[model samples]
Every structure is written in structure tokens, then in C-alpha cells.
Target: MGTSTAYGGPGGGTPLVPSWLGSDGDAGGLASPSAPPAGAPTKDPASPATLPPAPPTRLAIPTPADGSRFTAPRSNFTRFAGSGGSDRASLGRAVSGYVSKSSGGARQAAQRMGASRGSGARLLGFLTDVQARGATEALRSLDLEGLAGRPIDEVFMGLADYICPNAGTVDEGIAREAFIETIVDLSTLGVTDLDALSPDQMQTVFELYATHAIEARLCNDIGTKLVTAPTDPLIALRVQSQLRDFIRNGVSDALTAARAETPNLTQDRVHTFVDTIYERAFGILQTLGDAEADQ
Candidate 1:
């Protein structure tokens, strides 16, 4: 039997909506402009109603209480809480389970974002490209506007398809890891609230998530290698150091490229993204060590 990889975090629970998406009027959350300064005067019945809330001028990632930066958790399998197995087979069960537990609001939010016929096709292409290549290339090659306008479900379903192309044959554990990684990546993009985004902007966020997922998975693989190796202590130490450097350099390159490609990228977001990569790398190392010690 294949030994289970303790990917970290308990699996299965309600999907946590990004805090920014909350209805509360916190910074980065919904904006309800001070009820028009204590209602100085009531406007005409319908004199060209005020425009929608302006898109946020700035975005920020939440910081932890300990004053450390936020990093995406190793897994969000709790979103699939109560699912049977912890392995990849459990991933298959979770996938089918989520379809029936669809959130009406999530669906509506997706529809409002544009789940029309033509847009769905474009969304599919964009998702496919992001999965096959990295998010950066997908952004450069795909129709950003079209993909952004598609429904959230369309984008998510596309991701699901990519994760479980052949339910019968795909490795359940691998699929689970990909799904968790994607969630963690999306979380780092600081876009909990979809209303804060335009179609094109949303597409960019998706691309970023996809790219990060790919990177995170690589880090996880490296950590597995480090922990599982039965080599000499000195050689293992050298290998561990090399793997850590590789992850650091890779993250730096990705961030630099992302900033160059999207000038509007916020400093906080970039920092959070960088922290996420390092945190995952280090977290994996820690977990691997713990597991080996127990062995």
C-alpha cells in the first residue's frame, strides 16, 4: 500500500470565503460610503443613480496576530470536511460531493460575473492554458477579458476537469494536492471578494493562482525527496540546502516577472506571494522532519 503523505491540515469543512468578500464594511471588504454623510439631503427618485462602488484603489493581505505575514495553509481539505478517505480516492469522492452542495450565492455571483455561452468557452481555454502552462504565459496568450467575464462555476469546473481528467485513473492523492494548492494560491491573490474585480482583473487573479499552484507543488515534491532520502547526513544536508535555495530563487524570479508583467501588482500582494512560497517550502520541510522522526 502507498504510504499516505501528511500534506498538513485536517481535510474537510465548509469552504472559507475570503474575508474580503464579507458583507461587513471592513477595509478591503464591501464599501458602503458612510450612508452619504448623514443624509444631508435626499436625492430625486432616480436621478441617474450613483455609480457602483469604485474598485478598490489598493489591496492588502491580512497579517497574522503574531506580526508575521500570511501564508496559504498547506491544504484546505477541510472544505471537503466529512469526506471519507484522506487519500486521492477521497479526492474523487469530494469532487462529486461538492457538486451537490453548491452554494446558491456562489452560483449567482458567477452568473453576475457573466456565465454566458461564448464566455464559458473562453473561460475553458484560459483555465486549460493556465493548467498546462504557467499563469504568466496564459495571461500573455489568452483573451483575458473573455475569461474574466465567464461564470465562477465555469472557471472552477474547468479547474476541476484539469485536476480529475480521468476520474477512473487519476491518482486521488495527487488530485487532492492540486486542489488544495490551487485554493491556497487563490487565497494569496487577496481577492476574496469577487465584486472588487472586473472580468479582466478576475482572470488575472486566476492566472496568478494557477502559476503559484504549480510552484507550490514543486516545493512539496522537493520536500518529500529530502525527508524520504536514506543518504548520509552530510549529503542530505547538502541536498536540503540546494533544494531550499532552488525554491527561493524560483520564487524570486516568479515575483519579479509578475511585477514586471502587471505593474499594478501591489507590494503587499507580492510580499504575501513570496511569503507563501517560502512558507510552503519550510512547512513541508518541518512536516517531513516530524514524520521521519516518528518513523
Candidate 2:
């Protein structure tokens, strides 16, 4: 759950791309050429110099409307847990049932983003287009370029919006965060060339985004709603961490299973691929919940 402000600096020991790519640059882009030197003799109208300079290629900055925080529901469990009426097993069952019931809604949210005409599908189209064409061509089609020279984090936020298109929903926020996180992670994972990222790299990005989104969704859904917080602050943090890891394991398994079934992951099939992953992931989560209830 890193915030956008925390992304200002590159923390990894060494970036896979050139140092400049990870460093902050003139976000304003080149200022319009100084009015052609105040009436100095101009080149022929037909000459390249006479052509208007290309628009400044500024990376997009996110506005408040672009993203929102997940609003957790009031903790109904906390109300009764303090009275010694509920035990850990009952709490576990309540969490499992609640999350399992919510799985349908989560899957619907995922579908809205993954289906054709959704931002997630568009994101996949961009990646697959990169694979079919070159990265440069794909970017051009999307009106994005000069990425080789922009700050890595800036490029990340800009691209996140393009990929998820903040519908102002919690799910979209989760997806956008996941997209940026994937980029930040890739900076250390041998993704040396942003302008020419390979198809495998693009697919890796998508897959990681999906994993992060699922984990975030689960965490938001379960936080303090079904499980009461431990009194110790350190224990609370650890509990949260462990909960994330537990859910992430199930998500990973689902993605692995889905990937195995659809070995070729192309744009045409990305929607179905993602839908299958969501279905399997919720199923696995429900199974895990059932196990917890038994315990």
C-alpha cells in the first residue's frame, strides 16, 4: 500500500534501465522555442525549421479525481468481539462467509474492467499491440512516446491512468496502483528498455497487476470487518502482513492455473483469461475460508 508520494525516489540499488530513465526530468517538457528569436530571419516556410515545434510531451499528473481510497465498512465484528461472545473460529467463519459472498461482486467488478470496451481490456490491447507491432509503434498508436527519456515513476503514473482510467472506483484504484507497482518492480527486474519492452515483459506486467489487484481487494474487504485488531501495534501490522501473504498465495495459484490453461495469452483472449483467473481466485479464496472455518 505505498502511496504515490512515496514513489518520488528510486530505491532499488540499481535500475535496469539507464540512470536517466529513472531520474526526474523537466516534467514541463521543452518550453516553446523562444518565439523564433523575435523576428530574426526565418527559414523557408516549406523548410523543417519553419514547421511548428511538436507539443511539449508532458507526463500526466494525477488529480484528486483520478484516484480514491477504499472505504472500509464499519466493523460489525468489533462490536461483538469485545464482549467475549465470539471466538476466533466464529470470527474466521464470519470472515470467510463475508468474503465469499462478496466474491461475486468482486468478480463483477473485475469483469467490468476486463471485458471488451473496459480499460483493462484496452490495457491488454496496448500490450498485445506492442507484441504484434514494436513498442514504439504501439505507443504511437496510443499517443504516448518519448518515454525513453522520462522519469520512470512519472511514466508509471501516466501509464497507470491509461491502463486503468480511474473510474473513481476502489477496484480501479487498486488496478492503477498495481500497474504502477508493477512498473516500479520491473525497474529492478531487468526491464532495461522501456521503449522496447518485450512481449514477455508486457505480459509479466499485466500478470503482476492482476495479482496485486486481487490481493488489495481481499485486504480491503476483510480489514477489521470480520477480524478484530490485536491490541499490540506490532502484532496488528504483522497480522496484516500475514493476511496479505495468505491471500496472495491463493491468487498466485489461481493465476498459475489460469496461465497454464491459456498458454498463449493474446489480446483477443485476455478478457477471457482474466475472467477465468478471477473466477478461480475467488473459488480458491472461498476454499481457504472453508478450511479456516474448519480450523
Per residue, candidate 2 scores C-alpha lDDT tens digits across 200-224 of 6766666666665655544444443
Alpha-carbon TM-score of each model against the true structure: 0.26, 0.57
lDDT of 2: 0.51
Listed per model in order, the count of residue pairs whose N, CA or C atoms clash below 3 Å is 8, 0
Q: Which lDDT value does model 1 have at 211? A: 37
- Per-model lDDT: 0.34, 0.51
> Which numbered prediction scores highest in lDDT against the true structure?
2
Q: How well is each residue in 155-250 modelled by candidate 1, as lDDT tens digits?
A: 444455443333331123333344444455555665443334454454454344333333233323212333334245565445434433433443
The C-alpha RMSD in Å for every predicted model, in order, reads 19.1, 14.3
Model 1 accuracy (lDDT, Cα) = 0.34
